[model samples]
Target: MVATTLRSIKSLVPLLDRVLVQRVKAEAKTASGLFLPESSVKELNEARVLAVGPGGLDKDGKRLPMGVSQGDRVLIPQYGGAPVKVGEEEFTLFRDSEILAKINE
Candidate 1:
């Protein structure tokens, strides 16, 4: 798979059940309209699916379809994804089974 800059993440293509994800930045302001300090802003466990790999082969050698697709919003684990760096951009890589859930919105 090609490592891509965050701005150019769209061009990345994952391989073998891998998934490319861009984390959603924490909100700058709260519901009450209070601006949070940079240090206080918590990173969210949410991310947008940037790219997906072709399904891995099964024991029978048949390709398994991925549960998530490109552009899907998903809930990721708080930790455990492999960190990916590209031209000052940060992203994460996870296996298809590692994805927690798909968000409807």
Candidate 2:
């Protein structure tokens, strides 16, 4: 069941106001050069934007532009968004407003 959901995510295109993001993996090693267990590693709120919607419709039915685009690194909220799994890769779909911030680096 999960295997089918993990295929062909590249064909996905988010609708208005939606953005697809892939969560950045936590580091398995510490600065002190010690290996950290999976349970000990903390999941960061950072992710890279994979695809963005055309933006939500305005009052007059006009499409607004999205603040972030594909390949942009963005900060996401700790919770929320619809989880997506693709070929062992996990992703999340969030509204533009739900995105916390954009990472410059």
Candidate 3:
């Protein structure tokens, strides 16, 4: 997995109600300290928010507040979201509404 930093993706920003995030890599080893084979490692549906777009407009033409902000850990769906690449790092773009939940941890 590529290492991502705020400086590397500083130029890219989501437009409206879109969020940019980097997927959290799944652990290759189990709690027992045994290294698992590539096929056994399942991809996690968790990600770190890198950037967020300005809130979308409401029915009254006023801007609504975004649910999540940068640096927030969130739960995403298994599928969907547009894939984005910055330098060697890979990221995903999802609509704010598409984020399943915000992780407290």
Error of 1 at 15 (Å): 0.6
Number of clashing residue pairs, candidate 1: 0
lDDT of 3 by residue, 1-105 (tens): 334455677787898899999999999999999999999999999999999999888999887889999999999999999887666778998999999999996
Per-prediction tally of clashes: 0, 1, 0
| Predicted candidate 2 versus true structure: per-residue lDDT over 1-105, tens digit per residue | 223454577788999999999889889999999999899999999999999999999999999889899999999999999888778777899999999899997
Residue pairs with backbone atoms closer than 3 Å in model 2 (clashes): 6-87
Rank order by TM-score, top first?
A: 2, 1, 3
Candidate 1: Cα lDDT at 76: 97
Better TM-score candidate (1, 3): 1
Local distance difference test scores for all models: 0.88, 0.89, 0.89
Candidate 1 colliding pairs: none
Q: What are the root-mean-square deviations of the candidates from the true structure over C-alphas?
A: 2.9, 2.2, 3.7
TM-score of every prediction relative to native: 0.83, 0.88, 0.83
User: Residue 13 deviation, candidate 2, in Å?
Assistant: 0.3
